[model samples]
Target: MTKVAVISANGRVGSLVVKELVERGYDVTGFGRKAQNTTVAQTYIQKDLFELTKADLAEFEVVVDAFGTFAPETLHLHVEVIKHLTALLAGTKTRLLIVGGAGSLYDDPEHKTQLVDTPDFPAEFYALAKAQTDALTELRKHDDVDWTFISPAADFQVDGKRTGKYILAGEELTLNDRGESIISYADYALAMADEIQNGDHIKERISVVGK
Candidate 1:
């Protein structure tokens, strides 16, 4: 079985990723700052995410970074954590798969404007969005690390159900036939699991939306 570690495994998206990976027969482990009442992973590790070193993660074949933050003060941790992971996994065989944000995706066909720069972008999430954008920028600088950053659609619905269908795209934002950029956390998790099994987008950034 493929060994995988999911950081921040107690979070909404993280938990579902854990569930999906486990159901797919992967040897999964959940890492968090604290233990939760329930988790789908066969093993759980309680430790600060930053404190995790190469030695701690050397056993896993893949690491899924599902860490997220909305607080203005801590938003920069998004980039810092990605840097930390890449630095640790550099020259190693393990793959790092990041659960990224759509804010950095180009909103126009010309590839000129990002969704975060649009006038209709939510003011409340600007800081978080920018932080995630910076994280992607930082991840791009690492050439030795095997990494894949997967961004969700503009509408990342936490309460949305699994449709078992989605469309993947490149840097530009993608829309369904109905002209909407939306994806449920469940479907996003499904896509993540597929990527983990297939390893098709190594060292690339991709986006996904519901079909």
Candidate 2:
């Protein structure tokens, strides 16, 4: 069985990724600050997200960095963990899969402005958004370990249903017929797991939107 470790496996998106991977028959391992409520993982490792070492991740074929933070002051944790993990996993076969935000997604095909650059962007999540975008910059600098960044649509619905269908795109934000950008976490997890198994978007950022 392929071993996969999901960092931040207890978070909203992380937990769904865990379930997705588990259902696919991968030997999934959950790593979090505390035990998760699911039985899908074969093992659960409780450790601070910042304190993790490569040795802790050496066993997995893929490492999903699903760690997320809402606190504005400590939003840097988003980039810090990416920096540390890429440094450790460099030159190894382990692929780094980052759970990215929509902030980094470009607003136009010219790629001049990002979604976060818009005036109507929510201020409450601005700090977190900036941190995630910076983290993408950090991922772009590394070529050692294989990496894939997956960004959700602007309206990420926490309570949305798992339609098991989503539109995949490059840097540009995708939208539905109503011209709204959205995707459910369940479908996002589905696409993410499919990416890990397919290896089609290595070292690139991909986006998912509702159909």
Candidate 3:
């Protein structure tokens, strides 16, 4: 019964991750603004993300930060929360797993530039994408905490179902046979749960896409 806590558990990706963990028989808890999906969690906490302290999370062996926002004004908080969590869990055994965006993924094998740096990248998602990229940067600076950042495919499917099949890749973006970088939220959760159980990518960044 490994203990796990999922923040932002009400969101699309977060909820699916909670479901995956729960079905895997992990002792799971969910924290969010709303407590709609109580069945997926052994226990649910309704609290603001920032209001949660390290003490509140001390019970879990792993904490998954699934927090996300599309608004430009609050994008900086993405990195802020990372800094806060790193500082709080600096000397503890609790591991941090971040659900990162695909913007930071490399456009090529050389790893010269991220997808966000490409010329054709959409302007509307620039701020949010860069913020997620910066969050990964912040995680890299810390040597005291054990953390793993998992990025989704460039084209993440919100309504996609769980096929329980996905391809995992390193820092570079992953593509399918048709050359599409996409993954369903349900399948993404499968990859995430696998990482939690295996701990194979500790202190590293990885990505997943549909096979």
Q: Write the per-residue lDDT of candidate 2 for residues 148-185, one digit (tens) a residue.
A: 99999988989899999899989987888889899999
TM-score list, all predictions:
0.97, 0.96, 0.96
Q: In candidate 1, which residue ranges exceed 4 Å CA deviation?
A: none
Q: Could you give candidate 1's per-residue lDDT for residues 45-136 as a string of tens digits?
A: 99889999999999999999999988778898999999899989999999999999999999888989999999999998888889999999
Clashes of 2: 0
Taken over the whole model, the C-alpha lDDT of each candidate is 0.94, 0.90, 0.91
RMSD (Cα, Å) for all candidates, in order, is 1.0, 1.2, 1.2
The C-alpha local distance difference test score for the whole of candidate 2 amounts to: 0.90
Total clashing pairs for each candidate: 0, 0, 0
Residue-wise lDDT of candidate 3 within 22-136, one digit each (tens)?
A: 9889999999987475547888999877888879889889999999988778899999989988987888889999999999999998999999999999998889899999999
